[model samples]
Structure formats: C-alpha cells, structure tokens
Target: MLGAGSLRQQWPPAGKLHGATARGAGRGEPVVDRELSIERPDGSRIDVLLNITPLRDHAGGIAGAVNIVQDITARKRVEDELRASEQRFRTLANTVPVLIWQNDEDARNVFVNQYYLDFTGKTFEDVMGVRWHELVHPDDAPAYIADYMDAVRTRRPWRNLDRLLRRDGQWRWFDNYAQPLFAPDGSYAGHVGASLDITDAVLAEQALKETDRRKDEFLAVLAHELRNPLAPISNAVHLLRHPDGRRRADRLVEMLGRQVRQMIKLVDDLLEISRITRDKIELHRQPLLLADIVHGAVETSRPLIDQQHHHLEVRLPEEPLTLNADSVRLTQVLANLLNNAAKYTDQGGTIDLEARRDGTEVEIAVRDNGIGIPAGNLPAVFDMFTQAHRAAGRGQGGLGIGLAMVRSLVQMHGGTVEAKSAGAGSGSEFVVRLPLAEPPDEAHDGTAAGAGAAPLAGQRILVVDDNQDAADTLAMLLDADGAQARAVYDGPSALAALPALRPHTVLLDLGMPDMDGLEVARRIRADPAWSGVRIVALTGWGQESDRERTRGAGFDFHLTKPVDLTVLHAWLGTRH
Candidate 1:
C-alpha cells in the first residue's frame, strides 16, 4: 500500500523521520512513526501515524518499506475537546460577576477569579495560599475558617453568610456557597466557591420587619392617648348631669373646659403632624425679638407648668437677642419643649429655659430635673413614633410626635436639635441651635405687642351655633366681660334677628343643619348695611385648605374651636 517510487527515493523525509526508518530497516521489524495530521477539504484535520516496515523477500533486506497509516482522529478529537473545556471553564470563572475561588488539598487557595482580585484589591499572589481569611471581616474570619475547614474535612458542600472587607475598607454582606472537589479515585482534592452580595436584601428585610413592628406599636399608643382625654370628658359630662352640679357649677365648668382643652390639643397635634408629613405647613418668617418669642411661649405653656408645680426659671441674653423666624411656629417650638419638660418632671421639680449665643448660632436648651431619658434611647428620642415609654398609667403621656415634630420643624428652619441625658435619674436636656441673623430695623420699637388688650365693654356681639350650651356659654362669658351679648340656637333665627339686632359682630358656627356659617356670612355681606360687620370663622375645621376657603367666603379670621381665649380676645379687641 506504499507509493513505490517515492518511498524508494526517500523512505521518510530526512528532516522529520530522522533515523526511524533506517533503524527499523536495519532491525528488520516495524517502526511505529510519531503522530501527525493532514488538513481535509472541510478545513478540519485528521490525526494519523505512519507504521513502516522493511519489505524483505524472506531475507529481511531493506529493498523498500511497507508504510501503514493509522487514523487516530477520534481519540485525538476527545483529548483536544477536554483541553478546550478546561479553557472555557477558566474563562467563564474570570468573566462572571460573583467572586469565585478554588483551593488545593492543603486548604490553600490556588486560584481566585478576576472579580475577587479586582474587588478586594488583591494581587493573584496575595490571594493564593491560606490568605483568603484576610479578605473576610475580622469578626467573621474565624467562623468562616472553622466552617470551611469542617466542610473540607467532611468533603461536603457548605454555605455561609459572611461579611467581607472591600477595597474601600467597607464591610459588605455575602452569601457564600462552596462544593468540595475530588480526584477520580474519590480522594479529596480541593473546593470551589462563589460569593453573592446580599447587603441590600438583608437590610430591606430588617427595615420591613421594623416598620411592621412600629405600625402595631403606633396604633396602640394612639388609641391610649385618645382615650385619656375621652375618659375625663365623659366623667365631666356625667358630673354636669347631676342636680348638685349647679351648686358647684364653676368647678364643674372648669373641669369640663380643661378636658375639652385637652381633647382639642390632641386633635390639633394630629392635624399639625399630618400637615408636616405632607409638607403643608407654610411658615411666615419675620424679624422678632427673642424675648417676645420666649414670653409668648411662656404664656402658652405656663398653665401646664403651674399645674405640675415645677419651679421655672427663664434666662435670656439681656441685650435683646433676635431671630428672623416664624413667630407662631417658633413660639410653638419653645412651648412644646417647655410643655414636655413639665409633663415629664415630677410635681415641684425644677425646669429651666436658657438661651445663649455661640460663635455662629444661638442655642436654646430646655433642661429639667426629673426622670432622665434612658441612655440607649437617646439617639432615637426624636425618631417618629418612638416614645419615652413611662411607667404604668402614671404619665399624662403624649403621642411621642412632640419632639419628632420639633426636630422636623427645626430642621426645616435650617436648625438642629439634640437631646442629652445622664442615664436614668440624672435628668435631661434638649438643645436647639439656629443660625444667627442681623439685628432688627429701627422701626421695630422694643415695646412688645399684646401688652394693651382692649377691654370688651358696651360692644354689641351676636353668638350663633347649633349647640345651645356652646352658644349660651359664650354669650354669658361675653356678657360677664361687660359686653352686650345675645345667643341664638340656629342660623335662621340669627338671620331673622340680624335686621332687628344690627349687631356689630357675628360669631357664627359653620356646621349647622339649616344654614352654614359661610352661607350666613355671604347673606350678611349681601346686605350693604352689614358690609362693615367683622365676620370670623370660629369652627372645628382648621386645615390650611379650610382657612383658604373661609377667607374666600369673606371670613376676616379663621379661629379653630375650643379657641385660645387669649388669642381670640386679642383678635376681637383689634377688630373692635
């Protein structure tokens, strides 16, 4: 089967065959040639080897050679595919997103993927050997190593949730899984693993759980707070129903008023918090004397502080400090802080409101000698819905939004608020810092406002409401203040009396069956004779939208019900 002339001239190429054919020809046996390949028409190749022998006529003479070619293409193809598969595996490991690693039998890392190398800021040499633990968090390294060793010893699949230190020195969570590799004879060789980043998932799960817990707590606390006032109000109503109530009418009325005031406070807080959460509370900022602001806040909070019998001290910078701020809201802020101090302190405890100017800001601190905030809860004291949970039913507690609202409002004013406490029995302090501004203009006479409240005397006032008690009581109070007062139960009756009475002021209720306050105001304004009449909205609707609509309906002022008598009286005096 050989090409006779070509083999005779050169049995094998001198360059490749060297001395193979010559040796085989001398030995008179066959020489198995090395493997080779020939390219086919399809651009693929076939592996073949030449087996040559001496063609002797029974005399073993090297006259010519018998060349046999064997096709080893199938075996060669399988070997080449194995090598290619290994290359593909390495490429995939290097390109994947997750950090991947492989270790040798000695618990030494032999290889790490490109992701691991780049992300950990480690060179291949640094990651090799038993240096993998260096990449894990210091706190997690020991546990990871112990678990890895156990898995290797048992030759079993393993998994761990670990935190690893990144290149930037930040610790990141990872869910790592590994499987042991083995030699064909079933001896343990090494392990291969991958780590997936799970930081976001873990944090999300924790936050969701916390939110669910807080929601349940908030509902319970809200119900308790609402019921606190309801109980006193209900008791007051029962007391008023008794015949003897008339004899102690003044005391019963006082109790009833206090309970009503408490309920109104709760409702107002709810409305304010809702407005703040929706970014609905608009501030009207102006240059204001800090002393005037503090005085107004003191007036608002004085009733509670006196009720608690807390010794109060007010300290201010004598030079008349100032803040360009919303007087109403800032007054609210200071009052809230003062009110909190009175509520939390024991009867006869001492509380102080102190203010001073630091380098670039003014710091106001409300300090109290009472039950201190817990050390652990100080950080979360201003967190929404988080409470300084008091002892069993002893506290006239609030909805816990007071400080949270204070913080939010202060931050809105470009200020900061923080609380300081000495463990439990050492009392607490809340400090508020606001950036300083220039002094007031010369037109601002240092004489404070509200010092000259005009006496309500000889003024004709008409009180209108659906409730007989409210209308009658308001008229009585007005009459007691030396004013000419009349009470009417319905808007129709008030309208009927309007022409005859020709009152100077109309205190109208907005939620009547026959006619609302807005309609009443409109009808009054329609009469040119009543054009000069001052119309005020004295209603339960106190939302910003409610005020806007009232103004549009020609209401001179919007006063939410269970009105602050000081504010009401002052407003009425101005109108007169």
Candidate 2:
C-alpha cells in the first residue's frame, strides 16, 4: 500500500531516497536496492529497502518516479542481538583466572581469552593458527600435540598434565582439560579448553614422596644399628658364664660395659632428636668460658679418639672468650662433632679443634683429615637421620642424629653451624658460631663448686624398680659407694620397707604395675614419719613435663634412667 506519492510524503526532503528518486527521474534510469529507515506514525522505527525507477511518457521524456520498499527489520534486529551476545562472551572469558581457548575444526586456535594472552605474553594475532603451541615446553610438546590431535579426530574429551613456558622463561606445570565442541547441526567444532596452574601441587606431592622414602630408609638403618650392639653384649655374656670366665673376667666385663654404653648413647640420640622435633628441649644457659667448654668436650670424646687412634689437636684464642650459653648442651654439641670426626677418620689421622673470636661471634671448628663428604651431601649434612656415605670396610657406628642435634642446640642458643668440604677425599670441617658475651660480674673459678667429694659413706639408701636387674645393680653400685643400700622390686614393697630401713634417700622408678611412682611418692610424703627422706624419681621419662609432674608429686630430684653414675654419686655425696 506504499505508493510513490505516499512514500515521498513520508520521507525527508534531504533523504537518500529523494536523491535516488531525482537521479532516476532525470537520467531515466533505475536506482535499485537502497536501504532506508522509516518511522511510523506511532513513533516506532523499522528498516526498509527502497528501489526507484523513472516512468517514460509518450514523448520519450522522464516522468514521476515509481518506488518499491521491502521490510528488513527482523534481520537487522537479529544482527544486533548476535553482536551483543559476542561482546558478553568475550567479557566473561577475559575475566576468569584460568586460560580459556577455542579452536577451529583444523585444530588451529581461533580465539583465546585475555588470561591466555597475558600468560604467554602474546597478542591475539600472534597466538592464532597454532602459534600458541610454541609456549609448550619442548619436553612436553610432542605428546601434547599427539594427544590433542587424537582428541580432535575422535571429537572426545581430553585431559593432560604438561609443563608450559611462562613469559618470564620459567616452566610451570599445568593441568589442561578440554571438551569437544560441536555446532548446532552436530558437526565437529574443535575444542574448548581450560588450563590450570598446578606447579605448587606437583612440587608438594614430590616432596611428600621423598620424605616417605627417607623415613623408610631411616627405619631400616635404625634396626641394623640397634642389632649391632646386641651381638657384642651377647658374646660377652656367654663368655662370662664359661668355666674359666673368672680368669678373663676383667676384659669381658670391660667389653660388656662398652657395649652397654654404646646402646645407651644410641637411645639418648634418638630421644634428643625427638625432643628437638617437638620443640621441648630447654637450655639452661649461663655465662661460661669457651676454654672450659672445649676442655669438657675433649674429655667426653677422649675415649672415642683413643679407640680410633686419631691424633687430636686443640687451639684456643690467646685471650679468654666467654659466651652466654647452656654449658652442658654446648659441650655436648662440640663433643658430638669431635666424635664424628674421630669415627670417620682413619687410624693416625689428624683432627683439630680451634676456637677464635671472629668479630662479635666466637667460632669453634672441628676439622678432620678423614673421608670427606660428597659435595651433594654438604647441604643436607645437618638434616635429621642423614649420614654421609662412608668407604667400605670402614663402616662407623652412629644413628646420624648427632649433627642434627648439634644444629638444633646451636640454633637454640642463638648461633649457627655449618659444614664445609671441598669434596670427596678433601677432608671436612664443621664450624659453630656463637655470640660472645660480656664477662660475668665476678670471676668464675672454672671448677664445679662441690664436686670430687667422696660419696655418701654411711647413709641408708633404698633402690626401687620393677626390673629386678636394674634394682639390684643400682643397689650394688650404691653399696660400693659406701651407702647401706637395699633393692625393692615394686612401689608397695618400697613403701613397706621404708619403716624398717629408715633410709635417708629413696631411688624410685616411675613405671611400675599396680602402684606408680607418683602414688608412692604421694603416700611417702603424706606420712609424717618419712617426711625427712629425700625421694628421687629414677625412670626413662625425662621430658620437662615429666619433671614438673614428679615435682608436683613430692619428688625431690628426677633422673633419667641408665643414669650417669657420676651424676648419681654427686647427688648422693650432697646427702652427707
């Protein structure tokens, strides 16, 4: 119903349609297919296509124009909707954290999200047409490409883990997962994929596996080391029971003592490592002279040095050097290093202990011309349960916790320790650095104040333990030290014997059947008649909390079992 006259009336004078109409009328030609927008009386607009042509009169001259219009509103509306949807999709893809991508049917990347571009440091054009594959690590590209091509051919989901090179030139692990994309007509449209960074997770899993492996190795080594001491002790015991044992009794007894001491040392190292891991070991720090500490450590490791026949040298600073540290623990740390050097060195090898002030810190170094540590092991030398490889036929006995304990103890005292070596066959040195302290207000005599006195000569002492052997041996030791000692096998027997013996001191073990040491201590403290007796806890429980518990239960002293005879004698000497 849109005639030429009506169309002319509706259109503006300067409109494209008017120009086309005038040109068609004057030239007597046709203006075909020009698009125009038409507004209705109701204020609604629609798109239309216009065609104008000139009509000829009988005189062969131009006349008015004839116009034809076609509606194209639906097609235009669909185009706008598609453009907006594409914009929305691009915004969503760019906003995510993971790498998002799309590919064509030929497996060429056609579109990639902003994250993908940023990760690879490439533009859209640079990444298109399989150029993104350049970012895949060379080690991972071949398999990745093959797997992707297979997925594309089968039009199936795919997943893979591979390393990709970042813009910074670092290769990081990624978990790539993709699903096959298809058109509305069910034709293959390549794939839509996402890649997530999994570098941290991969590294953590690897470390966990390594730790588990080390734990298994440590367990196996511990079993072998424990069995080593048992064999010697067993042999000595058999020899002592022989018919002619008394003639060779002294030598066999000495061998037995040495084996027992070795086992006790191994157990002590294990306990110390446990304490360090739990952060439970407390340091009783004091102001002490470095010379004294060195002397004590040398004494402690002397027997081992002699056994190994390693010549030891000691070097100290000309001026006295003092440090604020736990005297006992510091001595133990140096002793462990010395023992390590002695055990690893060959017979007649020279070992050196040197102490000197380096600026504000004192450096104590133990150096040995023994089998050196491999360069690879130098970094892990202080790690728990780690040991340097030794030459065959020169196997040394240890639990590999000594250096670990040394590191922990030094760190506790605000110090640092380091192991240094050129490489295998170049010898090794362990250096400990501690902060120097101001000299004490008064000079220290460098001697134990009340030590070296004869032990209790006539004091009555009671030894109580569930292990009969432990109780009898302790009583025998006490009697040798001139104490009237009696052995009781349990806490009840200990409590019953106290009235008859009226002992001045009671050495009680904490772990017993029926009545524990705490109950016995409490009952003994409750009795007014036994109030003056000093009750000492002798057990394997040596933690700080264990000491606190015993103190609360009325124990005057606490001693860890396989008690040091010298320490027990010192306490007994104080009783007089």
- Top candidate (lDDT): 2
lDDT of each: 0.81, 0.84
Q: What is the per-residue lDDT of model 2 for residues 252-285, given as tens digits with 9 covering 90 to 100?
A: 8888888888889888889889988888776655
TM-score of each: 0.64, 0.69
Q: After superposition, how far is residue 36 of candidate 2 from its true place, in Å?
A: 11
Q: List the pairs of residues colliding in candidate 1.
A: none
lDDT of 2 at 47: 92
Residue 370 displacement (Å), model 1: 2.8
- lDDT string, candidate 1, 1-576, tens digits: 254323444545467675343344455455546677888799998887766664655564447756677889998899999999989988999998899988887778888899998889988988778657777888888889898989988889999999988899989899999999988999888998899989999999999999898778888888888788789778777877888867877887788787778778878888888889988776655556788988999999999999999999999987767776777888899999899888878899999999998976889999999788888889888977777745423356677788888998898788999999996777889999987667534443223332223256657888888989998999888887667889997878988987777888888888888688889888888889888888877889987889888878887877778866656565665456
Candidate 1 lDDT (Cα, 0 to 1): 0.81
> Backbone clash tally for model 2?
0
**How many angstroms is residue 297 displaced in model 2 relative to the true structure, after the best TM-score fit?**
1.3
